[model samples]
Target: MAESIIEQIRALEVLDSRGNPTVRVFVTLEDGTKASASVPSGASTGEHEAVELRDGDASRYGGKGVRKACANVNDIIAPELVGLDASEQAMIDRLMIELDATDNKSRLGANAILGVSMAVAKAAAQSRCDDLYRYVGGSEARRIPVPCMNILNGGEHADNSVDIQEFMAVPLGAPAFSEGLRYVAETFHTLKKILEKRGLATSVGDEGGFAPDLGSNEEAIELILEAIEKSGYEPGVDIAIALDSAATSFATDTIGLYDLKWSGAGRMRSDDLIEMAERWVEKYPIVLWEDPLGEEDWEGFVKFTKALGEKIEVVGDDLFVTNTKFIRRGIETGAANASLIKLNQIGTVTETVDAVRLCIENGWRAFLSHRSGETCDTFLADFAVAMGSGHLKTGSASRSERLAKYNRLLEIEDALDGNALYYWK
Candidate 1:
């Protein structure tokens, strides 16, 4: 146990996939075991999420520098956490939360706190010579998530006219993680070819999904479905569609009134958006609808859930922010059927798991997810399996950063030795 005690912690300012400055934390144990983790940034961040600290210096990284966060980890957080046991993950996380003493980790920066939290867990797992999933989720952690490949991008993630943020292809019927990955990877290729045939741009967005100027949001779905069928797969049975409206991105002006400026759909009330969802769910093989309503639109969410909750999974991303407090509200109010779990949203691994437990224990599902700006670290793949969350949305098949997660999941499935499970339910 003494050997697993933390000996040193440090942080460095690093660049995310978007070339913006972010925090990367490293931890060293007394026994010479070391691990590191990089924090991901969200382009479409929610209003209530823990603050990702950034240096306001306009000179460095265009004011997105995270040197303050790195300093917090090296100067303050590192000194206090040095002698703690790496294996005491929950206690260590709680201590950090207390140290911050802020509601949203605004002072210390979620980037700083989460980087350390993730590195400590990775170091502990290395010290035990165990996988991170097994270390955090016990030995039963072998459920590889059904990958929801974001093949089409819109809203904040893309400059296209389409309003939906993410249009994903879920290979729910695939026998295993590797096969499922292959299935979607093939579909991604097919979609690109189809777009080229129609004279659309094959360029991708921040999350690597194609960002072509389409006629409308529904047209993106049409292209994806066509690709799924053309790739020798059935629509709903073999591949299901998932969406992330990321409504908060568009919810910039008002609380209840939504401005559909990107799609030219005009300003709409909550009911109008709900009606469109009802139509889409009936028309397409849509299995999941994320953030159908904005974060503060609780009543609208409940109404949206009631309308389509039985038909599909109504997921809350910005609505929940991977925090147990808002997840509890969603659970109690019947606002959403599931929550999108992002590790950095809540600033600590323990709280992120707590959010998942809150959702699952209350008969709701957890959709482990990645941010738009991501790192090559495969912690998310292990985390999705660890939580037994049936699904995860990384990105399209093009970028190496996105593929890194899928490649890691393939490795994990093999590591499970025929014991791994994959499903959407």
Candidate 2:
């Protein structure tokens, strides 16, 4: 058998769903098998994540152009990666990281490196004539994750009055990924109707969730539950709620204080935030709460987890940033019971998998996530199933970019021929 050496690697600058420039890479194997992958950018990004290189030209896309990242791939990375075995995923990723020689992949650009990394995996999978999931995760990668559908958006994701970042509906009772998506879609439409009837604006946010100016965060949760009930589902039994505070967006220099400029509820302390979260948990069927505290507030994380982590999932997004070192620290300090896994956060498929493994090994849950600024790439759908992650957050049931992931999951479920295991089942 001849080795599947990389024949050519090329990259291009593309526009994402948010109209921002991103990097896309194309890879070809020795035998002519080809594949391509694109990288997503995040709006509510963590401070410690791998750097996403962007062109600083203010005239083009407001300094968000990724032409420089694309140049890095075409000029610097392609030369080193060509002629290497495409099937050696870890070695390929490590070589890219070493070539950059930066702690956060700044020299070669994480966007550039991740584009090549993902493209190589896809090419290798194509060479083997296997699905991306099976190629990346092996035979046991048959479990489909439940959708954490973001029904409403606020904070940086939207220009709404609601302080919470994301108000989600989790279809935990569906037996298959397709059915789960259907349920969530129905609920999303129902929510839209409720907002329309109330004379609220039905515009969407960066992640395709409804961006309505509801009076309070509690009102947003109430509307979602109402929509769930109207869509013919029981609140706690058939569907559950999830919240992504993205609290770092509202953080201040004060250790335990937050400045909610748009929330209308100003200057809330850590205790106040915990109390509010506790009330929400008691009143609603919220199974997950992500980034309730600012990323640097470890003391608040410990307190919040001790208070509600036993009954609900306390997830760390900005806190861990999908980095293994931060994950280990979070595990040791008992900061959270779950971690949000974003491939762009760590900049490679191998490192993303390592983060998921670390979370599982430490008895923590891993929730695969999508960025607010995303592309049509459905890699996360296959990755979620491949890694056996029980939870996935890919915006709402609207927008083509968000729907692309759900549609891919539907295709994967069909391909499984009833052998796929859903999260609820």
Candidate 3:
């Protein structure tokens, strides 16, 4: 019999219990085969609404732009996917061009494109009885431990109403995942109460560490190290500690004044950043340091990465948008030992998968992640585990939304034969 013609495309709109909308897309094949993709619209902090993009702007949206693009993908591009071949990634990519050739579709475009890519890949993976990560080339036998988030309690980024530099104890080696989560919740609650008692906001800060004014970056680093030690995880061995400076270390004021905003500490001086990094390497068992310098400081990154070696795992999230071009740059400059993989960063399951492949093939590690402005989708946990990322970083075991990812991973383990040996305590 002749092959059936590709038939239909459909988009499903999903809203969180909070009523925030997310879009999912699916395409059908001639033989009744189907493929699908989806992404959640992440949250925003400090009045910066996450930007969404569409057909024309997928090429340029980076950082917060990616999240906005994801929203647009769900709202616009998903509907266009109806009545298309489930396997036609090339055709779809072409259609992306035709639909928004002006590339005006900012971050929203990347999100939409990525959503469709993920759905299509998932459908294909389902047909093979394999997980998405495994289908995309990640090994299934290993599961790396997830990292604990260090939240900013108060300081410069704080609305200035409170004493911010507080840290909580996360019982990392709890025998059960749920128990660990509970411990985290209890600890965070206690920390919050303490912050409140001191007239400080409990959940505010830049990069969730170091208040804007408590001291210099060196002082912030000392506090973080002390906090990690107190959190009860063995610094380097048990659950590894990591930093997410959020590009806060690399900003220049509007008129070219450097670092005037980071509590007058100014932008991170490359030498000072290197010094802090070296200190973390010794004082604390820091395994990961993300966005340590500004995105444009390629030379600084190269210098740090070359100096740190395997003593630490330098990761790039803002520096690369999970695109081949950025990955290639990292590879060329030796800027980092690992890369943060966020599907929405480049907008497609295939593209993101390709990025991971590039990393793994080139000896770089993968650290799949979640957005700070986030929802409760837990698919990423499964993806991270299945893909064999060196590790995952969602959030501390505090909010239900944050813990949901860890909970989902536990559930997946239960479904399997008590497997999931990669995580401990």
Candidate 4:
């Protein structure tokens, strides 16, 4: 076996789908194998998540530029990792973590560290002449995830009337990944026509979901149901509804109180929201609900999960932040049955995989995810298959950045031929 030694690491400032400057890292192995990875940003980020370093220079990119992070990759991380084996992902990540020294990676920036980490993994996979999924997950990595395609936008992802951040269509009934993608893609187009017929805006949000100012958050689900039926799919059987409340966006300082200002439903208690969720869950074919309560409202989460955990996937997004400590706490408390997993949320592939392991080991689901702002990089697509989490939520079907992952999955499914598994659970 040849050693894939890290030769050079460099980061370039690049624009994400949201037009914000992000870090794109390039890694060259000793054998001349080169690979690059892009770092994605989140609009509704967790308060306790690893901090992303920015230029803070208001003149460039509205103080959102990641030039400082890029510098950290080029000037600091490159020197120490040059001689190390790129295949030793955990060691490389640990060395970078020590260099950062901050608990949330505030110094060198998670963006900088993660970019290099991902690029190193890609370079190593290329050097090994293996797919990213095979390199990371071995021969057992053949399960294709059921994409929770967010076809409608609200909350932080859009300027709209709905309070819920995302309304996703889960194509769990499709036999293969390509057919499943086609099912949702056809539904997305049908949804567009329905919205147009209703004289609503056909414009898209950050995640490529429709951003029409609808009557109510519940109405958004109704519209999607119509689209699914119109597209010749049965709701809950062929496709199911998934919601991401992102309650922290509307959560007040008072732990249980929330200001649902987006939908003009102003100020409601956690109990009220929980009851509302119960009613909606019973009424709709909802299979998953994320961020039902605020990050700080742990008691509310426990209560909410108790009411609906057995029926649906009560996911912790901001609640866990892709950290094992928080995930462990949630597992102990039974706060959620699943968690949203993102590489950048935890700052390293090793840590992100650790989070997935922790969730699965606890008999909980690990739901792979993409940030609100993304890129055309298909690392996440391979990662979803690698993790074998069975489900993922990567934006809507419209945006090219979002479609990139879905398209990559199609390629992998084709390549896998008869071995790939596709399902919701």
Return the lDDT, model 1, position 355. 93
Score every model by TM-score.
0.99, 0.99, 0.72, 0.99
Best candidate per lDDT, number? Answer: 4
Instruction: Give the per-residue lDDT of model 1 (tens digit) for 1-425.
Output: 59899999999998888998889999999999999999999999988999999999999877899999999999989999999999999999998999899999999999999999999999999999999989988999999999999999999999889889999999999998899999999999999999999999999999999999988888999999999999999999999999999888777567778988899988888999999999999999999999988888999999999999999999998988999989998898999999999999999999999999998999999999999999898899889888998899999897888989999998899988999988879
Q: Give the Cα error of residue 360 in candidate 1, in Å.
A: 0.7
As for lDDT, the candidate ahead, 2 or 3, is 2
- Please state the error at residue 192 of candidate 4 in Å: 0.6
Between candidates 1 and 4, the one scoring higher on lDDT is 4
Candidate 4 lDDT tens digits, 1-425: 45699888999999999999999999998899999999999999999999989989999989999989999999999999999999999999999999999999999999999999999999999999999999998999999999889999999999889899999999989987788888888999999999999999999999999999988888999999999999999998999999999999999999999999889988999999999999998999999999999999999999999999999999999999999999999999989999999899989999999999999988999999999889999999999999999998898888899989988998899899889998887
**RMSD (Å) of each candidate, 1 decimal:** 0.8, 1.0, 6.3, 0.8
**Greater-TM-score candidate between 1 and 3:** 1
Q: How far is 304's C-alpha from truth in model 4 (Å)?
A: 0.5
For model 2, residues 1-425, the per-residue Cα lDDT tens digits are 54479989999999998888999999988898989999999999999999999999999999989888999999889999898999999999999999999999988889999999999999998898999999999988889899999989999999989889999999998877888888889999999999999999899999889999978889999999999999999998889999999999999988779987776988899999999889889999999999999999999999999999998999999999999999999999999999999999999999999999999998999999999989999999999988998889999988999999999888988999999898742
Per-residue lDDT for 383 in model 2?
Answer: 93
By lDDT: ranked, best first:
4, 1, 2, 3
Off by over 4 Å in 1: none
Better of 2 and 4 by lDDT: 4
